[model samples]
Target: MRVKCTVSYDGTGFSGFQIQPGQRTVQGEIERGLKKLHKGQEVKVFASGRTDAGVHAIGQVLHFDTEIYIPESRWPNALNSLLPEDVAIQAAAFIEEDFHARYHVRAKEYRYKVSRSEVRDVFSRNYAYHYPYKLDYVKMREAIKFLIGTHDFTSFCSAKTDKEDRIRTLYDIEFYEEDDVLTFRFVGDGFLYNMVRILVGTLINAGRGVLDPYRIPDILKARDRSLCGKTAPGSGLYLWKVYYDN
Candidate 1:
């Protein structure tokens, strides 16, 4: 049997989602929990996407092939009992044998948070980008308008990315502020390495008057990493959701 699991985690304590030798990671922890349940049986879990270090996820989807037939109602309790507090299994159910968490993904949503305040809150320092500059929300929104729809996002990706096709369809990009918290939300078909962080950095630059709102079109046309702002901190990003068609 194959099982699909929806998980949520605070990534502050882990290296990242993927497992690496001698490094604490989300996959490693989850696999450990599975091992405990299955009497040391190693099961490989597949995730919808790999999040960078210090990045979080509210609805990360993963799947594993297992012969152990446990009731879905007991999955949460069973997994949580063996897993650490930072990682939690929200739901689990039987999935089609051929279903893949990564390949079948239809869309993904990521949000980058910024604390736009004069004084920073120590509690939120781990989850938000603290910027002391006064940001023009209107300008940021205007710049985001240029990001929606399909385009070559080469300029917004890390130079180290090996992806040959830089084209990606961004369903939406929006910014909103509530109190001292500013949220940048992006929904897209897929993202390249460090793509979201770089996008947020560019938007932040636009908000801080460093980049003109109208310059976004030119930036997209350039398709060069030098044309975009630096990649934002990984701590400020979260995998908000993933969508799948059937």
Candidate 2:
């Protein structure tokens, strides 16, 4: 039987979502938990997206094939008993055999957090980017408009990307502030490696007067990595949600 699971993890201690040869990863931990339930069998799991090291996820979706039978109500507790404190299985259910976590995903939402206060909060150090500069929220919002449709996101993607096609459709990009936190939310069909972080960095530069908001279009047209801002810290990024057609 195939099962779909919704997971949430505090990625502070994880290498990333995908399993590396010898590194600690969210997939490795979950696979171990599954192995505990199904003795002597290797479990394969698929995730909606692969998060970078130190990047967290609140609504990560995944699927796995297993022969062991466990009630959906007991799935969370069963997995939690064998998993680490930072990783939790929020829910699980029987899914169609054809359902795939990655291929079936319709859209994904990512939020980048920035601290606008002069004094940084120690508690939020792992969850937000502490910036001492005063940001112009209006200008940031204006800059985001240029990113709200399909475009060649080559400039925003890291040079290490292996994909040849750089075109991506951004459904929506918005900027808002609440208290001392400035939030940048991006919903897209898909994202390239480090795309969101680079986008946030560029927006930060615009907010800090380092880059003019009106130049956003020109930057996108340039398709040059050097013309964009630095990639924002992974600590400030979160995979907020993933939408599926079915």
**What does the lDDT read for residue 113 in candidate 1?**
94
Please give each candidate's TM-score.
0.97, 0.97
* Clash count (model 2, backbone only): 0
- The lDDT for every candidate, in the order shown, is 0.92, 0.91
lDDT of 2: 0.91
Give candidate 2 misplaced runs (Cα > 4 Å): none
Judge candidate 1 at residue 115 and give its lDDT: 88
Which digits, one per residue and each the tens of the lDDT, describe model 1 over residues 1-246? 888899999999999999999999999999999988889899899999899889999999999988787998888888899999999999988889999999999999999999878898897888998987888888888888898999999999999999999999999998788988989899999999999999999998988899998999999999999999889999999999989897
Q: What is the C-alpha RMSD of each candidate to the true structure, in Å?
A: 0.9, 1.0
TM-score of 1: 0.97
